[model samples]
Target: MSRPARAHLLSLDEWWESGEDREVRVELQEGVRIVAPRPRPAHARVVLSLATQLSDQLPPGFEVLIEVDVVIDPNTPATVRVPDLIVRSTTSVEFPITADQLALAIEVMSPGSRRTDRVTKSSEYAEAGIPHYWIVDEDLSVTALKLTPGGYVATGFVGDIVTSTPWPMRISLER
Candidate 1:
């Protein structure tokens, strides 16, 4: 008889515990591993620009997080991530993001990052129950996505004018 497909299993807790010694950021979803490269200068610029703009517009008690790991669970499938920009309305923000704490997550697509963002992370964020997830493509000049009960659905594309409110007020994205 053919051997059953060999399977390797790891609790999500182990994944988070292991990330401390790794070189780059790693996240897990249902025990699957994901790795992403460090941001390039242009990518960094976009993240910083958007972070600054959002920070300025956000009201008190809310804050913008930059390149920090957002832990999505505390159980065996504990998923952790470092999104480009995370806007939280909570007075205190901490790691291990639960379903309710996370308000919005924005990812700036890097070269060749379309598949990962549009597919992998998209599914994972939805599973994590993050309210709003936006994927920003530098080349296409587009900010796309809308969170739904199942996952993120590509609803609209903003080339020059992008408006949303993770914070109390509206913030726009140009270019």
Candidate 2:
């Protein structure tokens, strides 16, 4: 089936009010709507487990948020991404928190999203200066990256316990 195409570039507000946003698993990146396949049951399970685990060990002042639209840039040609999880400051009470308030952005890799998570998102998150990014595999091992002036560098660990920064909290997602 053909998806309906919008002619104009979308801002954050337009994407929110446009009923199309509610009708699908869509992300708006640089003003275009990107539709992704529904996540499989196993993928959803990992996301849930991570959210619960992360929240339990969360440091003071930070909170773990499940799939919610993260406003990367609120301009007319907007960029919004809904990651599997986002660790953000508790200070921001808004529905879609801006990128600066994000401490870490986590992506649980689904089969269809491997490349997008590994390559595309890492670039975008770094550009947004989110500081840390976690790429969780299907088996639940995490590869964490730390942002630098140039880009993200692998901060991979030795075992099940993985830690990220802005604050130190060890996360064990091992099965």
Candidate 3:
């Protein structure tokens, strides 16, 4: 016997209402729901370290958040991403943040999240018009990117210290 055809995609409201209480991290991509496993120790550490460093350097009216849901599509609401860290101004008040209010989105790659972080999420954030995106690997190497008219372009990559634009901050991953 052959497998049956899949059902229709879930609307953003429908997906939000489903709300099955679980520990897994969930996101929506083009009306499809994606569930990610919990972060490992290395991922958590990087997130914490990056958030702390960025938070301290952010000027007034800008703040750093960790593991927050970012609504990438305003027209359709089909994609909701939970970036590992986000930097946005204080003007946003809603629970799920919209793309325009965000300055940067950062993702610390986990074993399971490498592909999505590097490819899928990067594309989505760029399409959403977020200015900056950073990816941190397990080894603490960082890739800083800026969204241009064409797409995301790598600005810098460093294993220890990273100083990039859009944010006047210097990050040191040295132990």
Candidate 4:
């Protein structure tokens, strides 16, 4: 169910342990609450398809998840990013996975989320040391970004990117 927007500073523990049914998609931005609308059909489809493909090709220890909360920053007034998809370790049966467990964080850009995905999340994921990040635009243009000491750098590839970054697989950003 949706709730009226209000100011709530959420901690990592309160955010995870509070099991209230959060129907509206809410993400914590440095302890502040931000709500996002649900994804469109096309966005949802791409996420599911990518998850299926990734799951099929992933090694035993890694699994792909869709629209899950990731603890981007663990400090108080924490930041939790709900990425479109993530390739994380299956070893931990945790409710909300930390950035260290994540191998890749994927964001399917929406009309309202283009800037956040490309700039905001890109920097956040890099700062959290997520290793890899991918940005999928509405036109199915995929920008594969790898984390660097300087920042996140685009691999200069589009559509489909083949990688052995912890796992070997070919991910196609096609319909």
Candidate 5:
């Protein structure tokens, strides 16, 4: 049998206290601590490229937050997560955010992020009612998973170019 998953037992508040400590970034979900892999340059490049492309289309009132904390729930801390890119309609609050506060969450998938993006993070985004969730797969050269009640509905891939109005920003994702 496989070994049980390793998790840090801490509340969302505690995670915030040491958010940037660098040992690990912990997100509480269903009583489990998900320590995301350290971001690589490739991953950062994809996130920045996509953010820049989308930023140009954002309305004056909207703002794009890069690698920010988004609290998905007010009561239980189980759903708190930090998405790579978040498009918010307004600039409100400083840190430690709630899910309903965002319009869209974009996750750029690196080589090792398949399971997290497709499973854990996807579940959290949907359950929190995030209107749009983009899973940009560098491997497949596609953007998968449009948010739905059951799960992310498969949308067209970003082969050459992708045009989406997932939020206030009209984004184009291409290689």
Candidate 6:
């Protein structure tokens, strides 16, 4: 007997409808479906901490969301991604927020996601024209990047006090 062929990719709507009752986190990248591992305690801590800080300090028209799917390219539904946290304007709230509406996408690095966060996701976000991207390392160091005409440029790296542009907020990572 021959084995059945497997699906290598899923469109955004398909993935969403299929995953509605599932607990596993899934993301689509370059026409492929990827299963994301559950965040460990340390990773979850950073995610919540950052989300809380951003949500508390964001301006009136902006809001912070956790693990929300962002559609990088509506034409290619397989290009959806779920960032650890996203900062977006609240003026036009919508499900599966598009990349253009997002002000920032943040990823808390884990052993399994270091490369994806630093390289693949960075490139994707830049290509999608999201203005800002941040990577929070295991040690709590943060690397902030801003989108430019050429691509994403590292704006700053901070471990203690974080003060960056495009968002009028300061965060201290000291514990």
RMSD of 6: 1.9
Each prediction's whole-model lDDT (CA): 0.69, 0.82, 0.82, 0.84, 0.70, 0.81
Q: Could you give candidate 5's per-residue lDDT for residues 34-146 as a string of tens digits?
A: 77667888788888887887778777787888877688764534456778899887776655567877777888786777888888777878888887787878763555466
lDDT score at residue 111, model 3, on the 0-100 scale: 84
The local lDDT score (0 to 100) that residue 146 gets in candidate 3 is: 91
How do all models score by TM-score?
0.76, 0.87, 0.89, 0.87, 0.79, 0.90
lDDT of model number 1: 0.69
TM-score of 5: 0.79
Cα TM-score of candidate 1: 0.76
Q: Give the better candidate number (1 or 4) by lDDT.
A: 4
Off by over 4 Å in 2: 1-6, 19-23, 157-159
Q: Candidate 5: deviation at residue 82, Å? A: 1.6
User: Which digits, one per residue and each the tens of the lDDT, describe model 6 over residues 15-104?
Assistant: 667664245667778668778667888778788878877887888998888988888876644688889999888885587689999998
Model 2, 57-153: lDDT tens digits are 8888889888888888888899999998999889887776888888889898988889989998898899889988989887667788889898898
TM-score of 2: 0.87
Q: Rank the candidates by TM-score, best first.
A: 6, 3, 4, 2, 5, 1
Most accurate candidate by lDDT: 4
Best by TM-score: 6
> Relative to the unseen true structure, what is the Cα RMSD of model 4?
4.1
Q: Indicate the worst ten consecutive residues by lDDT in candidate 3.
A: 155-164
Which residues of candidate 3, in runs, are more than 4 Å off? 1-6, 20-22, 74-77
Poorest 10 consecutive residues by lDDT, candidate 1: 166-175
lDDT-wise, the better of 2 and 4 is 4
The C-alpha RMSD of each candidate to the native structure, in angstroms, is: 3.8, 3.2, 2.2, 4.1, 4.2, 1.9
lDDT of 4 by residue, 9-120 (tens): 7888887776544566788889877788888798889999899889899988888888888889988899998999999888976765889899889998989998889888
